[model samples]
Target: MNLSRPLLLASNSPRRKELLASLGLTFEVRVKEVSEDFPDTLKREEVAEFLASHKADAYKEDLQEEALITADTIVCLDDKILNKPASAEEAYAMLRALSGQTHEVITGVCVLMKEGKTVFHDSTTVYFKELTDAEINYYIQHYKPFDKAGAYGIQEWIGMIGIEKIEGTYFNVVGLPVQKLYENLVQLKIVV
Candidate 1:
């Protein structure tokens, strides 16, 4: 259902934009530069929501009638957060650590309105098949997933062959927990 007010998505991720579009909601992409930094004291599960909340804070004064949406995603292994890789080598190392292991993908979403704000998160367990050294190298060179958390994309080639299983929402692994986001939007009356 169309909303009474405009929807503003404060993210530059094409994946997130596409996911929101798939829900049949009309929105405007209003990019804002928000740092991904979080307190070192924050737990792995809390980091994403903290960051997403910060993203919303950056535009709190500008929320006229537009409901704003922001999100953050992270990959966790053994309680350690794996953010986007800065280099191909880092991506390879992150992927190697994930090989044959079950890791967690968490995404935090924030929906802010002039009246109130909602912040929440969803996590998924991803199991990867044992990957050969050559396979890791080839994937890094071919897919260039340095921008994605966990050094990989669940919808990309590495995910198709490397990811053995997932225990939660697949879209959460892709960077946005769209199902939960949709539910929150409806609850907040952003969509009918």
Candidate 2:
């Protein structure tokens, strides 16, 4: 947790906070409202990075000695991006679409300091077993994953039983790519 500068995490997600803390990094949590909207022309794979960097841009002038970290996660099913669900029906629909299908979970992170900035991303391919209506309903009622992208948490009950395999880092699906982020922190000399 020896950081060269004060570390600031700009996200309200508990998962992101937990993941970052798991790295044994001492940091402060800070969040600012930023628009999640992206241009339609942006490639689906790039949306996460775009949003992450957009969030970091907000504090370009505000940041000084502290290294600001911002992250954005998205669940992509082919050409579609499954964002956080707004309602139970939406959550059910997203989970149903994910049933027995392979999707990509992309998490983009931006680290900004007064010296410079670094933006990167990590992608994980997740395979889900065919989920039943009952299972989906049960999870929705119990977990209420409305705050999570793709209507599910890979660390939750649904993910425990539903995820069959993953081709990349498991933490990416949980909302942060700690391995990659850790490497970036070291490279940036934030972690000494």
Candidate 3:
């Protein structure tokens, strides 16, 4: 483990903060504003990684002696990407569309060290039970999922009752995939 370099996490997501904290790694948050908009030509699976790399690029100059971690998570249904909902109606629509469907939650992570950079992605298949309009409305109004991709949080009230099953790392759906991040760090000799 390298103690001389500090680890900087560049994201505004509290879920990402909490998920990274769970790994017992010490880090500092350095939020950067990058335009999340990407080319429409990108397949649904590429968007997350592309945006994550974009975020990492923003911190490239600042990490000469630090490890910079940047991440992006997106929800994909039928190959279409669902990002954060902008309005209540949009949130309801996203939730309604996800009702009774299995969607892919893809999280892209980038770890930039002094001499190298690693970018990877993880996908989780989440199955949602059939939800009623009342349920969708309730979650949109109560949970206020405007900040979450797919308009819902798997760790919140909606996921507690609506998610029936999952096929990959549950923490990926939360935000940063901590296990993969830790393994990558170890592989790169950035952490023990």
Model 2: what TM-score?
0.98
Per-residue alpha-carbon lDDT of model 2 for 22-140, expressed as tens digits?
A: 89988999888999999989886689989999999998998879999999999999989999999999999999999999999999999999888898899999999999999999999
The 10-residue segment with the lowest total lDDT in model 3 = 1-10
The CA lDDT of each predicted structure is 0.92, 0.93, 0.89
- Kindly list the per-residue Cα lDDT of model 1 for residues 13-48, writing each as its tens digit: 999999999999999999877778889999877898
lDDT at residue 186 of model 3 (Cα atoms): 85
Model 2 residue 28 CA deviation in Å = 0.6
What tens digits encode model 3's per-residue C-alpha lDDT throughout 29-123? 99867999999999766888899988899877777788999999999999788989999999998998999999999999998876878999999
Candidate 3 residue pairs in backbone clash: none
Better of 1 and 2 by lDDT: 2
Off by over 4 Å in 2: none
What global local distance difference test value does model 2 have? 0.93
Who wins the lDDT comparison? Answer: 2
Model 2 alpha-carbon miss at residue 44, Å? 2.3
